[model samples]
Structures are given as C-alpha cells and as structure tokens.
Target: MEFRYLGNSGLKISEITFGNWLTHGSQVENDVAARCVRAALDAGISTFDTADVYANTAAETVLGEALKGERRQSLEIFTKVFGPTGPKGHNDVGLSRKHILESIDGSLTRLQTDYVDLYQAHRYDFQTPLEETMQAFADVVRQGKALYIGVSEWTAEQLRNGHALAKALGFQLISNQPQYSMLWRVIEAEVVPASEELGVSQIVWSPMAQGVLSGKYLPGRPAPEGSRATDEKGGANTIKRWLADEVLSGVQLLKPIADEAGLTMPQLAIAWVLQNKNVASAIMGASRPEQVAGNVAAAGVVLEPGIMNQIDAAIGSLAERDPAQTKSPASREA
Candidate 1:
C-alpha cells in the first residue's frame, strides 16, 4: 500500500487505513472480523483505526485479538474517546480530564497495547472546557500512552482553538477524522483550509459514503437484501437519506466515470478522496475479507484532473458542502 505522512508529522501511514467501526463487535462475527484484519494485513495496510464507543468497547477487544501477534512497532494503531462508553454514566463520556485519563487506560487494555499511535477526541466535547481536554491529552503524550493527538468531526474553529492549546501544552494535534466522500464535502470550505494552514491532515471516513458511493444501491429499487441500507442495526439510518431517487440517480451518473477510470465505483470514491492533498488517508471498514481486498486497490490511485471534474458534476447538488453542516453535540449526551 502507498503511504503518506500524517499531517506534516514525520510519521507516515498507509493511505488506506483499515477501520473497525461497525463490523468488529456489533455486526460481524469475531472470526469474520479477524479474517478481515488478516485481509488488510495481506493487502499491505499497516494502519488500524478503532474507537472505545464502538460496540461499547468490545470492538477494541476484538481488534486487540486480531492484531495480537503483529509487531506493534510496525503498525500505527489509533483509538478514540469522548463518547458514551460502558453504561453511559455521567462520568463515562466527554473529554473531561477524568474521562480522558481513565478512558486511555481502558482503551490500552482492550487493545492489548501499551500505547496507541494516536488517541483522538471522538467529538468536540462542548460540555467540558477545551483547556481541560488539551491538558489531559498532553498528559497522555507525556506519559507515553499515546504518541499523537487527533480529533473527529470538529469544526474548523474548534480545531484552531484546540491546536493552539495543544501547542501551548508542548504537544501537537496533527489529525482530524471527518466524514468526507464524493457526496459529503462539508469539510472542504472551512475545515480543509484551516487544517492546511495549521498543518493538520484529514483521515477521512466513509469515502464511499458508508457504501453509498459503491453504486450498489440503485434508484427506485429496494435495497439489496443485505446491503448497508438494509442493515438497520448497523447503517440503515445513516444511509436512508441517500437512498432517495435523486441521490441514487446522481450516484448512477458516476458508473461511466468509474468505468473510464479503470476502477470500480468504490475504488473511484476512495481514490477521489485521496486526490485531496489535505486527506492523508481514507478509512475503510469491511465485513468480508474480499471487501478489504477490493478497497486496498484504492491505494496509490491517481485520478486525472478531468476525471475529478466529472465526479463533481456527477454528484452535482447532491453533495453536502456547507461549512455550517460540520457539527458536534452541543451537549455530550451522545
């Protein structure tokens, strides 16, 4: 797999990071999940991403077992806190010092690693002071629990403020994990520009729009029996809006573009996101081993300038580009 430096940091990560968001514990069997991890390794992916909130921390355990024998130094393992994990107690969530400190320990234990390559704030914890959170992250770095700090779905303003604080604390906040795809451009107008200025790179999730951009869901048709749109427990809610006729029709327009690029719809989608220099990696989740194999092909792909234009035109008004659309919980109930 091709590698790119994460942000301006000296560390490089596989452009395609294998992530276990929904599949590890909630949706797929443990054996299947392990097989998928093996598939990722076989495909040359050395980067792995997970979060404590995923399946209430069981995902981390599964990931830990999956990577049990690999040389930890050769892999860049990442995990996140700041969500309601384990019984959703009042003290179980947010980026408060208490939660951040305790959560890191739980994460490390579950992942069977002494430290994570990156520890991220799963979302901006509006309920807690930013300083408190940054200071805790600084401690994580200083204590050798995490090598780097990152955040997910943070607004450009939030990133700017958090970065300044992290710098003052003698650490660097180098990455932001955001939902970015052919159909989602919310981060482009503000977040991307600000990140470019601040030396933060995006590790984008759902480059295939939670599988929507794979073009397997057709317009005016019932979702395939086991498609993401049909999996209520996993992705049906997040994917329902894109199932509308207009959106589906728009996605279909890209079939020819993918064909011309000598790539599949999913590869085209992942490649399209990697074309953005600000995006360091596109996180892909797989339920099956072959899915991992198919997605790794997206690594090292270079879309022509003209092909990029075709994607924009094909997605048209269906893409969400409003900077205002980037949001975090106003209160940390989530």
Candidate 2:
C-alpha cells in the first residue's frame, strides 16, 4: 500500500483507502463489516471513509465497533455530512450551521472517537451561505472535533471559494472527494485544473466505475445474479449509466490490453486513474476481504504505453457514440 500526501497537507494516506458505502450497514452484517475492515487494515489501508447518511447512520456505528481491538491511533477516519438521513424532512439535513455542529457530535459519538481525520460536506448546499458553512467547518477544526475539512461533488468554483474562505478563517482545506474513473472525464475539463491551481488534492471515489470496469458485465447478456447490477438499492443508477451498451463495449475493447499486461480490467482501470498527479488516493468499496486484497495489488502494476494507448482508443470509441451518456456522477471530473 503506497502512501501519498493528501494535497499540500503534512498528512500522508494510503493510495488505496477503504470506504464503506452500501456494503457496511445496508448490505453486510456487522461481523462481515468487521472482517472487511480488518482485511483492509491488514492490507495497509490506514484511511477509512464513511458518511452520516449511509445506511441511516449505522455505518459509523459498525465501523466503530469493528475498530475496538485495533489501535485507534493507527487509523485515519473520514466521514461526511449534507445528505438527508431521514425521510426528507426540512430539519433532517444540509450544510447549515445547526446541521454541521449536531452532525459532528453524532458522528463522533457513533465513531467512538473524539475527532475525525477528515470531515467533509458531502455535497453543495445551495440553501446555505458559503461563509456560514466555511465558518462552521473552521470551528470544527478549532474545536478539535475534526483535524481537517473537505467537500465532495462540488464544482470548481465552489472548491476555490471554499478554500479561500478556510484560509481567511485560518484553517486548511485539505482534500476534495469526487467520482473519477477511466469511464468519466468531465473532471478533466475543469475540476482537475482547479484542484491543481488551489493546491487541493483529490481522493476519487468509484475508481472502478462500480464494477463495470471489474469485467463482470458484458454486452448482449443478462447481468450475473447477486452482482451490483442486481442489487435492489445500489445498482439501478450504475446499470443505467455505467453498464449501458457503449460503456460495456468500451470495457470489452480494453480486455486484451489487460491480458497482455497480466492484469485484470479493474486493475488497469484503477491504475489509469492513479496515473494522474492530482489524484491523491482512490476510495474503493469492498464487501469482502478478497476484493480489498485484489484492489491493493492493482496499485503496483504499471501500464505500458501501448496498453495505455489501447485504453485511450477504447475511451475514444465510446465517446463518439452518444458522447453525452458516459458521464456518471462518480466519473464527472469535478
């Protein structure tokens, strides 16, 4: 597990970070989640990502329970806010000062830790004043409730403005979590450039396109049962966007390149994302220990120029057909 500086901050994190989205609370039981966390730590993943909204706040509890026997100081935990955790009520969520303050306390309690390594606003909140949100985040840093602050799925302008506010308030905005993958290139248009300019490092999510790049999906066939494509809650949006005809065709086209390099499609896809200097880490969601082990190995495989060219050609071909359809929320460069 290679480690990289998370932006300009002094902290260094594992290149392959373990994140619990659906697999923790919604899909796997606590015992299974604990096993997965142990597997990740064994593989040298020091960073663990979670959110207040995932599984209605159960993910943090599960994670906290799992880490009971491990040395807490050895792990760097990250969690997020700004998503509705309830039944879409007015007071249920957002980046408002009330929500930020209350959410941190709840998260800290559930996580069994006094402070989070990285605390983030999960998304842009159009209703809240940016200053209020920035100040709230700064307060958390000052109060020692969180060590660093970040934002996710925010536009380039939002990242710039937020970082400026944090600096003025005497706080460091260290990272931005966005969906970036070989299949998604929208970030290349502006987000990537903005991060480079502002000295913000990116920790990209869905580096494998949610199993599409894992080579389990194929064109002109029914998706295998029990895969993400078959998940009742997880795969609908992914299937509609990533498992579409054009994307699957692109995956098929890249298979030979992976074979030639003695790599799996997922390994090539993940390495391709890491090749970018701006990407600090790739957050992978794994339901089982073997998946975590496999993903860790991908970080070591170097893609030759010819194999990279084949990937580029496959992406080019996919771009030509309905160029608008390939951008999934996870892959938008921003």
Residue 256 of model 2: what lDDT? 86
**Candidate 1 — which pairs collide?**
none
Candidate 1: deviation at residue 93, Å? 0.7
Kindly give the stretch of ten consecutive residues in candidate 2 with the minimal lDDT sum.
325-334
TM-score between candidate 1 and the true structure: 0.99
Which candidate achieves the best lDDT against the true structure?
1
**Candidate 2 residue lDDT tens string, 1-334:** 8888988798888888889886798887788888899899888999999998989899989988887777777888999998877564676688889889989999999999989999998887777888999999999999999999988877788889999999999998888898888777667777778889988888899888888888888988888888888888866556567777777887898888888888877888888888888988899888777788878887655677888788888778454222233232432111
TM-score of every candidate: 0.99, 0.93
**lDDT by residue for model 1 (1-334), tens:** 9999998699899999999886799898999999999999999999999999999999999999999999999999999998899889989999999999999999999999999999999999888899999999999999999999999999999999999999899998999999999899999999999999999999999899888899999888889888888887958998886888999999999999999999999999999999999999999999989998888998999999999999889888999989998889898876
> Which portions of model 1 show Cα errors greater than 4 Å?
none
- The candidate scoring highest on TM-score is 1
Badly placed stretches (over 4 Å) of model 2 are: 86-88, 317-334
TM-score of decoy 2: 0.93
